[model samples]
Target: MTLYGLTAAPVARRLGAVRPARARPLLVGGDPWAVELARALRSAGLEVLMWAGSEEQRERIREAGLELAPGELLAAATGRGARLEGITAVLLLTDEDDFNALASTVLSRGAGIPVHRLGPRSGDHGVVAPYGGDDTLLAPGLTRLGVAHRHAQGAHIVTHRVDTTAGTLPDRHDLLLLVRPDGRLVPADGRAAPAPQPGDIAVMRPRC
Candidate 1:
């Protein structure tokens, strides 16, 4: 299935509603991408646990004032009393494809944690499988999409009309600018909108 299909907006909306119940994510790897990812997750209000591969990388994270747990991803995930409780997501930011793939497989099977892989390359080989089970967030694509979507929906206030094109329904109009589903306006031919259900048409205007 496609990434958009895998990530249902409504599900994400619901998940975003309640604070994540899993422990803060445990990032595995010592690359520059891993450091940046830890910072980003912390900014998003999620706890970040770093598992560095080397002493130099560990020091870098320590100097940055973030929590550090010295262990590889597999070791950390498999350690006794290791529960993923409160982890919102798991990010595999390693440069090694083999490491990222193995981490993704293990997390999904072992802890049921959503795993995302970050790297500089892209291809079907890099795409995580077990289809629709876990999530993989690649560099640039996922991040860019998120940034663009946020920018598009960031206006404090917006006004729009809901014009109907069929069925004897009266034309409706509403104004909203909020970021949530209730206030945003989805246009015709918009791929971001939910899939159509029975009797749904392209010109149906959402009522406030």
Candidate 2:
């Protein structure tokens, strides 16, 4: 495995770069926005597995009609076990920025499953930061809890199908996730927001 330090998660990528279409995603941590995201992803027709750090979170996940991640997955994330199975990707959404960063390390080590998390607050650039901890997701300078608070304030996630006939997307910089027609996700946040094109589902949220 090769480890690359990033303004994102700064994790070790396994031997290959071929990413599978995201059919099942494992969501780590149980924050208000994270729970809502899982609900949205499920409505979009993907199977989402929820894992919580506390029993309270577990109840919330269950109440939301979401599936909890397997028990063994906890041992794996703590660095005492094996790679997770079934889920193609992982999203670390813990409220603690450092905890999310640390979990990404254990989960990414030799585990081909792709991992993304909220950016750490350790840096001074602090434009808020986006979710790209593993360099997968992107956002502004907000911490995990900060994002949750934003969601409560009516910030939202929406998808737009690019159509040149109507001109280009108005705010490309606020982009978070880009889903290609083939189901591959292209990162389009941070300073390197990819140009939006037709036939792609652009998931966008505000910088806050």
Candidate 3:
């Protein structure tokens, strides 16, 4: 069973990388992930509008000097009276997974923009397609190298099939749950565990 590495290139091609000039991502909710995402997007020079769910959340975001979305989707129109059509992309970063799914569906149907969710959850969220490229700044624990804060926050367990034909191995201090080719979820602690073979699924939250 040979192992392969999955890079941002292939995923970018498949997901159609968002152009900076055309990137207008609407962030939903007031979660830490949403805050970090907004910061990252702005750092990249993209326009961002946020809907933080409550007045408190909105105030917090405003204090941070970010733009806020309208109270309701019906009021979400551009200066020229165009509806959500101006939105290039939508990101659902709420803590409620169900709410995220519902909002994503609504935005996709109404705005016709690419919608993405933060972590793995139910329903069809765009992260499954790995839309963001290497330049996409993400909250910790979403990627293999995001295990820095695991000690304080505990690890975020993520389940995914190895997209690469060559597969990958767990680094030291990381935990892995290998779903064998025959469909077995086996736990392997860190470096002691063997490399995941091709076609095998892995649940990895690296300690990096």
lDDT of all predictions? 0.41, 0.60, 0.47
lDDT of 1 by residue, 1-208 (tens): 1121112222222222333543366666655545654664454444777766667877888877788764433333334322333555555555555455555555455444455554323354444532322244422233323323433454111222222333222234111111112212112111122332222222221232
TM-score of 3: 0.47
Model 2: clashing residue pairs? 9-133, 127-141, 128-140, 128-141, 128-142, 129-140, 129-141, 130-139, 131-137, 132-135
Per-residue CA lDDT of candidate 3, range 1-208, in tens?
0001112232222223333444566676664435544654554455777876567777878877888765443333222321333455666555554454444444444343456544432236443323322222133333322433452375444455665665765444343345555433343422245467786666555354
TM-score of each: 0.47, 0.69, 0.47
Consecutive 10-residue window with the lowest summed lDDT within model 2: 1-10
* 86-109 per-residue lDDT for model 2 (tens digits): 566777676666566655665576
* Ranking of all candidate structures by their TM-score, best first: 2, 1, 3
Off by over 4 Å in 2: 1-22, 75-84, 122-136, 142-145, 164-173, 206-208
Which of the numbered candidates is closest to the native, going by highest lDDT?
2
